[model samples]
Target: MGLPGTIPPAQGPARPALAVVDVQPHLQQPATDRGPGRLHLSAEGASRAAGGSGGGEAVKVILLRDVPTLGRAGTLVEVKEGYARNYLLPRGLAREATAGAIRARDVMRQAEEQRRARVQREAEQLAQGLSALILEMRARAGAEGRLFGAVTAQQVADALRQRGFPVDKKQVELEHPIRVEGFHRVAVRLPTGRLVQVTVNVVGQR
Candidate 1:
């Protein structure tokens, strides 16, 4: 009630951002658990992810990339129809995991697998050579053989590169910089998570 004359404002509950599940004509699938964070889903399994009638209108989708709680790339998972139609589909993060879509991706999946295997083989071969390596480095030292400056991973990596090995400083798993001169066994980590030990011989110079 206003003193003179005032129109009363209309009152209504605020709508939730993702409340309405606007189901479209989008027909979509089950996800297979590949190892830990991956999956290879079948057509039928993917469709099951999208509920038929009982699941409150869920939609199955194959993720193009990892979604926080949903699934990883290539994994088919169920989501709200609204989420699929509005967010995931438009953002290019996922696609409808239809039976045909699942079958169509088989060739691409195989090629990716082959590429991964080849990379693994290359990493393993390099790791073997690094394991048998004895790398020597010279640095200025005191009477007690303590280095004036610590030997770093960058220096080690540079030395390895000079010897014709493609090494990155990041791959040198040095727990700490070497302060004292001696034979220190350093681990060179590979892309496949394998650690190869390479002996680093630090000699004192004037």
Candidate 2:
């Protein structure tokens, strides 16, 4: 009835290796959406939205505190309407959608602005003090003005200490170790949002 090795007809449906389906309407969630979020009130009166709380007919704003990465003052973030009502607003982390909350938010913003200005003023004062910083070096150099190797942070720190101004090596911010002989301005980090600039004058050895 058949030639050698001829196969018979198949009967049942083929098995599925894998199944892929569209996401159900309930499960179709967005990773990030812009909507209402929780508005956190600051002691200084600035309002920012804390993480997670947000929503409603009125736009929600979540107020966050002075997180290091997020800067000095609190910040507001908008989130979705539904999420704000069901989760964020009820948790006391954020206030309701109203005119009173908005007015309070403006006050909070003004307070934060004043604080920033004060910090900036202090930073300028620190910079001015650093003008007197002069670093001397003891290196073996030739007529062309190139050093034997390169000047490093350890060298700079040691020299600063001998001059009576004890500076920490870690506070120095250099793009690269000083190799060429020239005058350069190096930044020194200080406390309370302050920064100091030190002058480096590399001269040839006699």
Candidate 3:
């Protein structure tokens, strides 16, 4: 028997002693255990991580011809390794701008400049010719001046062709399709970066 509030001893091993369980050391390694430089990436691995092909680095190239949204001929441009390798290099549109390539580009620079000047002069002359020219188009329309069908760039181009001007429909830039009968100013973009406006006189057909 035990006094009040006193714990009685266990009768047998079926109820063993309440000893603290020993905790074994954790087997998992800490992040700090793997120090810096424990793993080094090769050149190929680094290149892949940097979005390059294989182990190849990006290169500087000289344009051999005009590239839309890019530099013109003889201009040095830096591009991705894959683009230089696959597109520009294979198409002969660009080359690695080494000392030799720079020399070659220098030799052709004068000719390219002359060609560009000639194109500019021709575009200016064409713009001047088109300035005074008015294209008349006849379309069926209602009494309120609303056209039965919209006037397209192709129709305007055809009118220009009939008037002895050689122009493609793509050269004409219209903000919207002409849907009314009236005189409207149309803008055309020339290859030499010149913008020319032509008067398109839309009249109702009799």
Candidates in order, TM-scores: namely 0.59, 0.40, 0.51
List the candidates ranked by TM-score, beginning with the highest. 1, 3, 2
Top-scoring candidate (TM-score): 1
Task: For candidate 3, write residues 1-206 as lDDT tens digits.
Answer: 89999999868658567999854222133267655322223334323432444426767899876654455777898766765675567767778889998888887887878999998888887898799988888999999999999999988888888877768899999889899999999998888767899999999874
Candidate 2 off by > 4 Å: 1-62, 65-83, 90-115, 140-145, 153-173, 180-182, 187-197, 203-206
Candidate 2, residue 105: lDDT:
74
Model 3 superposed RMSD (Cα)? 15.8
What local lDDT does model 2 show for residue 104? 77
- Residue 58 alpha-carbon offset, candidate 2, angstroms: 6.1
Sliding window of 10 residues with minimal summed lDDT for model 1: 24-33
lDDT per residue as tens, model 2, 1-206: 56789986777999878988843212123236523332333322222222323323435554433322223333454545564465445644445535676677778889878998877776566566566766766667777888877888877767766766546687677768887788878877755545677998887674
Question: 1 or 2: which has the higher lDDT?
Answer: 1
lDDT of 3: 0.75
Q: Number of backbone collisions per candidate, in order?
A: 6, 22, 0
Candidate 1 local lDDT, residue 202:
99
lDDT at 47, model 3: 32
